[model samples]
Target: MDGGFVYGGSGLSTIDGKGRCTIPSDLRSTVEASSNGNVVCLARHPDLPCLMGFGTTERDALVTDLKKQWEYAQQRGENFDRQAAGGPLASSLTVIGFEASGRFVVPPMLRFFGKLEEQAFFHGNITNFYIWNPSILLAQETGFEMQKEIAEYFLAEAERKRK
Candidate 1:
């Protein structure tokens, strides 16, 4: 549960028909260092259109937070959102192992949920990384365009925050 894992970087990888892909070496090493043995947890991203990859430390922290929420809800006599919490934590998590060559198979269900084809785009976000279908990640129809309007809006937002 030490906080030394640095999951950052972006790259593209191939996902074969059977959902097997080779983890990028740098990312593989990072996960290997923090995970128990060679196992990494995979889940469908709750909000984003991607797969969430977690190391042991981050996964432990997530479970801790969920436990706290459960305790709070119980004390207050409030309904616990077990579906929201346990959906990803228990039901949907695809626990998989990394091979000596850093190859791993994405569970069929996860691959389908991610809409993964032949390629996946990996974007690291500190504690975890997103495994995105290249088509989905690049599709502008999803409002992910990076033209002038959105860029300027983000710039103005940053400026406003700076003050």
Candidate 2:
């Protein structure tokens, strides 16, 4: 799939008890443009610090890639130590699907990570995204920027955006 979808900048949004957040207008546009109007939320685990929102096309491509990698490893007799490593991105991912209306749910554990008090930010991470609490993003003191190579490496919506 063509990842030419331009990632709009990040913005603040609120989360409800059910963990739903409204897609920022620009983000919606970015999602609509690339996804042909559909989007999905992805989480590595409820214990993770951030969440990812992805376009369906990217999601599918990632799943396919992951499965291929897993298969190759299996064929090569990659050891249990190696098998203990990575799996299908789907296996690595947990997600919430969304409708065209622009509201999506975050997993309960993810919501707890930020003590999510209604506001969060959606930052693009090239192949995926970061759904973060505003305070968490601000609390970071590291001079390093995440995904420095993301924008150049792929059709990332925003590779990584930080203050």
Candidate 3:
């Protein structure tokens, strides 16, 4: 699959010395459904060290949504525009073919970002696939929960202020 798509899930797999990792057998069927495994996009997401996966279908739709959102932000003002534009995102990975062995070549930059080694987590996040170092994934999960606590604190404060 090499177009816009959407999917999300957790499937355990390992990356070989050659930087190839396999999708779980169950997931393989989904990949096969795509034109070319839907050109899996594995990338890091904001506030998480985990990998996010998107099928080719979701990926294309995301771009459209982002563009619309960006435009809406611009209408709001420079502050909104700045917020949307001030981030480095890895949304431009291409789908490299998979081997008969079921291993796929992950990009070097993505590999480093993911800190991938022998074992990694493969996630299908509806717009792409994310490859994450398992430890990083754990840390990310913990950090996200902590962030929710902080956000709750702020929300409570806002409620008090409103009163």
Candidate 4:
């Protein structure tokens, strides 16, 4: 979350028949460093039609932020349901382990939620990265111009490779 392990760069990967895809090299190295291993925590974006991926450190930061929010609400005499606040965050994330080669399985629910098909586009956001179904990303009408352009470029590149 600070000086180390910033998620940056973007790439595209093809989903294999078994619902597995390889994380791009630059992103994968940062994930390994931040998590101290080959595990990545994945969850559906709370507001988007994509999957969010991060390491343990980012996950810890999210938990700490939630606690701070609860305390602030308590100080204001507002009733904070900690369980309700944390339920979606806790239940949505799934821990996935990748091989050293950076290949990992995509959980079926996440895959469906993300609308992933043959290809996924990866985009970095410093603390985390988004895994997008390329067409779905391009279909987004608001914001994400840079991400959409990148996804389009990758989709073009993949098409070129096939011919």
Kindly provide the TM-score of model 3 when superposed on the true structure, using C-alpha atoms: 0.62
Per-residue alpha-carbon lDDT of candidate 2 for residues 1-163, written as tens digits (9 for 90 to 100): 3577655455556677777887767677777666766656465534445566667766666656667777787889874333344442344465455667678786666566545666667666556567766555555566214432322222233334421
Score candidate 4 by lDDT.
Answer: 0.90
Candidate order by lDDT, highest to lowest? 4, 1, 2, 3
Off by over 4 Å in 1: 75-77, 140-163
Q: All candidates' lDDT scores? A: 0.74, 0.59, 0.56, 0.90
- The TM-score obtained by model 4 is 0.94
- Clash count for each candidate, listed in order shown: 0, 2, 25, 0
Comparing 2 with 4 on lDDT, the higher-scoring candidate is 4
Per-residue alpha-carbon lDDT of model 1 for 1-163, expressed as tens digits? 3478888765566788788886666677777877856878889888777788878777888788788899999999998985687675466677789897778998888988888888766666678877877667666365535422433453456458669
Give the winner by lDDT: 4
Clashing pairs in 4: none
TM-score against native, each model: 0.76, 0.63, 0.62, 0.94
RMSD in Å for model 4: 1.3
lDDT of 3 by residue, 1-163 (tens): 3353344444556578788777654445455555355345555566455555544555465566667787886787744453344344445345556654446777776677667777666555454556667555555534445434433454456458669
Best by TM-score: 4
